[model samples]
Target: MVDEVKETTVHELIASPFVGAYLVLRPGSPRGLKIPRDKYLQLGRKAADDVCPAWLVEATRRCWNLDISGRGVNDAVVVRTESPYGYGRASYGLNLGCNYDREHCYSTSA
Candidate 1:
């Protein structure tokens, strides 16, 4: 059950920001994930604060570098937005970063 939960969470995480954007922007895109430039940095900083597991945060940074580095944007971070089916067209740019110190990273009401 724990493995199942982890798998689900990882899937959601990938689908929420990483691979989700890639699929929308570049269908049949090559393997790997594409996180927004700002998100990439935000996750790195958040990881320093111990917001999430260091491995997860580092993976995002590495993937962002590997995916975005060769795209003519030297030290540039790519930004793309799209609305997936059935989900509200929300902007991830608004998400500052995860605050593990808080109840949740996305609880705006708090």
Candidate 2:
């Protein structure tokens, strides 16, 4: 008999309502994020205070880099250009005042 194993991904984890909402409510969001709500909360240990959000974003950006060679760090992740849009700005609490009307502001999805 052979034992079967299963692999889990960040997207699968962030699909739950709890995890989804937490990520959405986070400061810097990705492009098309899809994960379990409970799992997302577990990874961030509280969506309000995610430490290495950029690191996660960077991983996704790497995929894009494989296609576009000259994109450079600028094309790494949406967070790199999401400050102006209010997607990468979590320090403003949860009031939803972001306009997202500039190249600087962008969103990256996992």
Per-candidate RMSD vs. true structure?
15.5, 17.4
Residues 6-110, model 2: lDDT tens digits: 863222112123211333222234333443444344443533333434434454455322232233321222221123333432323233465664333354534
Q: At residue 55, what lDDT does model 2 achieve?
A: 37
CA error at residue 14 for candidate 1, angstroms:
14
TM-scores for every predicted model: 0.20, 0.21
Q: Clashing pairs in model 1? A: none
Candidate 1 lands at a TM-score of 0.20
Residue-wise C-alpha lDDT for candidate 1, range 1-110, written one tens digit per residue? 35553432111132234323432122222345544555545533442224433444455456443233222221222223334543423333434453345433345683
Ten contiguous residues minimizing lDDT sum, candidate 1 = 69-78
Worst 10 residues of 2 by lDDT: 11-20
